[model samples]
Target: MLINIMGFLVSYVFCLIITPLISKLALKLNAVDIPDHRKVHVKPMPRLGGLGVYLAFIIGLIVIGFPIMSNIQVILGATLIVILGILDDIYILKPYQKLIIQFVAALVVVYGHVSVDFLYLPFIGTVDLSVSIIPITVLWIIGITNSINLIDGLDGLASGISFIIVFVFVILAIINQQDTILMLSFVLLGSILGFLYHNFFPARIFLGDSGSLFLGFMVSVISLMGLYKTVTVSSLFLPVIILGLPLMDTFLAIFRRLKKHQSVMAPDKEHLHHQLIKFGLSHRKAVLLMYMLSATFGIVAIIFSKAILWGTLLFSLLVIFISHYFYNYNFNKIIHFLNRKYNKT
Candidate 1:
């Protein structure tokens, strides 16, 4: 407990101290985001803020005395992810280039023996993946990595959502008594909160591709370490629920693009956040609403973790119904009406 608190504080302070330096370096290196048609920010902002987050997390691990050898592969893969992000932030790498790097990094993590070998389905009992674990792990890492990046639409949006998700992971880790995962979750949550202080509305700096990609990679890895270790089918569903919003957004984006006969990687302004903005929510409100939605999913995951098989099924159905109804029936009108009512009051 003491060490976990120390890890969180060390990461928080490190990010607080390092982010300003990174901001200056980003400006000096001309690595800044310029406002464009698909962007929300009106001014050029320094990026590479992920450098601070990555450094702070590494330092926190060192401070916690975590075994270097045990995490060598994750560190190596994360290094590759950070490098890819830096290059993308600087030169705007093509989607294929970024995808190749992601695949290589995923391979390195898998090679380090972090593959999902089996699953415990509700009625079917244990199902072995055998060789199929390789592709499954790779696909999960890449999918999560891009899901996070795709949702980096608003200031503090990605980092804030990530912080919430990590917070839930921390709770789940405590419940499961996974010490290593608990420590990692604390450090990640602290680092993201530190970064969010500056990256929030009217942001001072951006996480760039580097921060988002690194965060996505770490989140996926941590979920595997903690949640995916369980034998129950609910274990498989936990991550999907915890990361529900971003995964849904990513899939919707791909489907939307496919229907339009466009490349799945093409940039656009039709994301969930954009749709909320179109529905009369301000930027901060939209982000806050998304945070609430993510937290709702997190709560569902927590309940599902403790539920029996029948209870899990019921909870899952409730979640799907509520989510669909919230979006389809009352999302815009309710929020807008509330805003108006509150303003008038």
Candidate 2:
């Protein structure tokens, strides 16, 4: 417990100290985000904030003497992802190019025995995924990687969501006796919390692709380590519940793009955050509302871990319905929708 606290504090303080330097370095490298039609910020901001988080995580691990050699594959894959993000932030890599690099990084993580090996369905017993595990794992990694990246539209939004996830995982880890996930999650939590200091509204810096992708990759890989026990279908939904915000946003984005015959990777301003802002919420309010939603998902995930199957399902449905309602309808209308639903029921 003390060791975990130390790791979190070290990572947090170091990230606080190092992020400003990273910001200056971002400026020097010409890796800044320029405002355009789809973006909310009006001026160019440093976009390499992920470097601070990455460096702090490594520092935390080293200071704690965590065995890096044992997780060499995860480190290598994360390094590759950070490099890809840096290149994209500076040079604006084509979508296909970014996809190829992400695929390679996903493969690296999956190779480290982090892949899902099987699934225990409702009626069928444990079903071995066999050859399908690799692709499934890779897809999960890439999907989550981009999900965090895509949700990085607002200041501190991605960082906050990631923190909620790691915090939930930390509790789950304690419950499940997953020491690795607990330690890694604590370090991640600290780094992201530190980053949020400069990342919130009226931002000092943006997470850029580098930070968001690294966060997404870490979340996916770490969840795979502990959340896929598959004791029950509800247990299987733990990761999904914790990561509901980003995954839901990503799913909606993909669906909207497909419906419009647009490329799935194309940039757009119709994201949940954008929608909330369009519905008259202030920047901070919109972000805070999303934070509440994400935290609710985390709470449900914790309940799921407790094997409260029916209770978890009920809350999950409510959360999904509310989230979908907010995504498609005005914020003010949510009260009316809930009232009508209650009256109908």
Candidate 3:
């Protein structure tokens, strides 16, 4: 416990100290984000800020004496992701190019024996994936990697939501008594918090593709390690709830694009944060709202862990209610009308 605390503190301090240097390095390398129509920022900002997070997290693990062999595959995979992200930040790789690199990284993680092997269904018990685990694991990793990248629209948004998600995992790891995961979670949490200080609204730096991709990769891997390995049916939904906001946003984006006969991979300004801004919220307010929503999902995930089947049902209802409220569809209005009528009677 003390060691984990030390790891967290060391990671926090390291990231805080290194972020400014990384920002300057990004400027020197010309790895900066120049705003345009689809972006929210008005000026060019240095990227590659993920360098601080990556270095700080690695150093934190070293201080904790994190077992290398046990997590060697994940480390190797994350390294590939960071490298790909750095290159993408500098060169602005084509979508296909990024996809190929993401697949390779996923393969590294899967082959490292970190792939999902089975799932516990509600009635069918544990269903082994057999040969399917390979593809499924790769898809999961790539999907989540892109999900985080897709939601990196607002300053401090992706990193802030990720902080909440990682913190939830840290609690879950403690509950499950998974020491390695706890240490990793704390280190990651610290790393993001440190980076968030600079990455917030009126930002000094951005995570670019490097930081977003690296974070997405690590989050996916940690979810697998800490949540997916559990043998309960409710455990299957835990990661989904914990990461609900980004994953939902990603899926909605794809659906919206597809409905308009547009390519799903094409970027647009219609993301959730964009919609919030269009609805009159400031950038900072929008980002904070996202944090609250992400934290809400995190709470549901924790409840799911403890409440099992009932918790899953409760989470489902909450999702429905929240979706209706946000969309301002007729369901909520109808409910209100019906309640008023019942009161009058």
Clashes of each: 0, 0, 0
lDDT of 1: 0.90
lDDT of 3: 0.88
Root-mean-square deviation of candidate 3: 5.0
Distance from true position, residue 274, model 3, in Å? 0.4
lDDT of 3 by residue, 1-345 (tens): 899988889999999999999999888888999999999999999989888899999999999999977888899899899999888888899999999989999998888888788787776688888889889899999999999999999999989998999999999999999998998999988899999999999789999999999999999999988788889867778888899999999999999999999999999999988987776667887798789889999987887887666656776787789888867875445445544564578
Over the stretch 1-345, how does candidate 1's per-residue lDDT look in tens digits? Answer: 899999999999999889999999999988899999999999999989898999999999899997768879998999899999998888899999999999999999999888777887888988898869899999999999999999999999999999999999999999989998898889888899889998999789999999999999988888877787788869768899999999999999999999999999999999999998887888998898899999988998888899999998888788779778876886678878966875688
lDDT of 2: 0.88
Ranking by TM-score: 1, 3, 2
Q: In candidate 3, which residue pairs clash? A: none
lDDT of each: 0.90, 0.88, 0.88
TM-score of every model versus the real structure: 0.97, 0.92, 0.93
Question: Which candidate number maximizes lDDT?
Answer: 1
Strongest candidate by TM-score: 1
> TM-score of the candidate numbered 1?
0.97
